[model samples]
Target: MNTIEFLLSRRSVSVKLITEPGPDDEALDRILRIATRVPDHGKLTPWRIQVLRKDGQARLGDFLAGRFTARHPDANEKQVAFERDRPQRAPLLLVVTAKVRKQHKIPELEQILSGGAVCHNILLAALAEGWAANWITEWPAYDDEVVRLLGHDPETDRILGFLYLGTAAEAPDERPRPELSDVVSRWPQTA
Candidate 1:
């Protein structure tokens, strides 16, 4: 597909609708290569990718369940199970971490934005490779314990997104979009 057409037609498949047969190791490596090709101001690659395969997903799910149970002592078994199964929704999960350098010449905000671009690029690359993907950062992404469970210091690293990849059970319908005239504006005045 051409660039314009691809951009216009791109949409995220829901995580629950994503099935198995995700990208293999070689394809995943290629996708990651493309994902990192975004703009970097100072050549400081301020992001990292963490691959959470099947077993890792289960482990993360268990960890999340434990954390949830601890925080919500009055929670029922169903709620705990929900937390435990959350990470297993997708076949593969890629955690994009924004490693912001406070003293670097490049601002911290730019570094964080770079991580966001990485997530978008991953989604695009997966779609181009005929795989459905979704970028998400739910409750676990913000929790300090979850960050530590992912093996990163919560102080310096932030979870930009959890990219879920797999085959789509069914194509998602296009949702309504904003009108260009309503969103776009001219910068300078023309009398």
Candidate 2:
């Protein structure tokens, strides 16, 4: 497909449907390099990508479950297990974080947005690399303990998303996309 066609058809496959055979070390290296080549006004480069696979995923899952159980004593085994298994849902997970530089000429929002761009770029790059990918940020992304566990300073840093990349077990159906009229606009008004 051409560049425009590729962009128009780009969509995420479900994480549950994402199986093993994720990008190899070399492919991941290429994806990461391509993912970071996004717009940065001041070139702050505030984004970070943490790869979690196999042992790393298991450890993170256990820690997240423990934290969840500690916070909610009434949570049953099933509830805690959900958190525990989240990280292992896919063969590979990339924790995209933003270390916002405050008190700088670069606006905090801009720095944070740079990280957001990195998140999307990752998805695009993964797809380009012939891998199924999705970007997700559930409750854990906002949890301070989770950030701390990942060795990031929650005070100044934010978890943009957890990018899951792997081979697609099955093809996902295309969903409806917003119309240009609904999302696009003109700078100047007519009539």
Candidate 3:
């Protein structure tokens, strides 16, 4: 599909069976490069991508569970279960971190906007490649322990979102979007 068609047709695919999601190195690199071509003001690429594949995914889950357990020694069994199983939702999880650098010319907010644009581009690229992609971050996103375990300096790097990528076993249902007239506004005054 062309650029405009791809943008309009792209939709998030959830409930992916994901039997195999190991994109080849060449394809993966192309996707990463496309994902990074977002609007970056001041040329500050204030973001980083972490790919948790195979053994790494399991290790990350263990690290998070351990930290969660340590943080709340009095936590119930359900909380522990949630923490442990959170990482298994997807076969491959890509963590996007917004590394806000202290630059005199650019504000932290703009850096954050750039990181958000990166996440959107990733989803778009995945869709264009006929792969299923979903961006998500639940309780772990806000947890200090999780951030520390993920090797992010919370004071500088913020968790933009975790991208879950794979192939879908079932087609997803598309929902209706708001009409342009409902959202768009004209600049000049009309009678």
Per model, state how many residue pairs clash: 0, 0, 0
User: Candidates 1 and 3: which is better by TM-score?
Assistant: 1
Which pairs of residues collide in candidate 2? none
Clashing pairs in 1: none
Models 1 onward score TM values of 0.96, 0.97, 0.87
Instruction: Tell me the spans in candidate 2 whose CA falls farther than 4 Å from its real position.
Output: none
RMSD of candidate 1 to the truth, in angstroms, is: 1.1
lDDT for each residue of candidate 1 in 85-149, tens digit (9 for 90 to 100) = 99888889999999888898899999889989999999999998989999999999999999998
Residue 37 in model 2: shift from native, Å?
Answer: 0.3
lDDT of every predicted structure (CA atoms): 0.93, 0.92, 0.80
Model 3 alpha-carbon drift over 4 Å, by segment: 15-19, 67-79
Better of 1 and 3 by lDDT: 1
lDDT comparison, 1 vs 2, better candidate: 1
On a 0 to 100 scale, what is the lDDT of residue 8 in model 1?
Answer: 91
Query: Which scores greater on TM-score, model 1 or model 2?
Result: 2
Write down the worst ten-residue block by lDDT for model 2.
Answer: 182-191
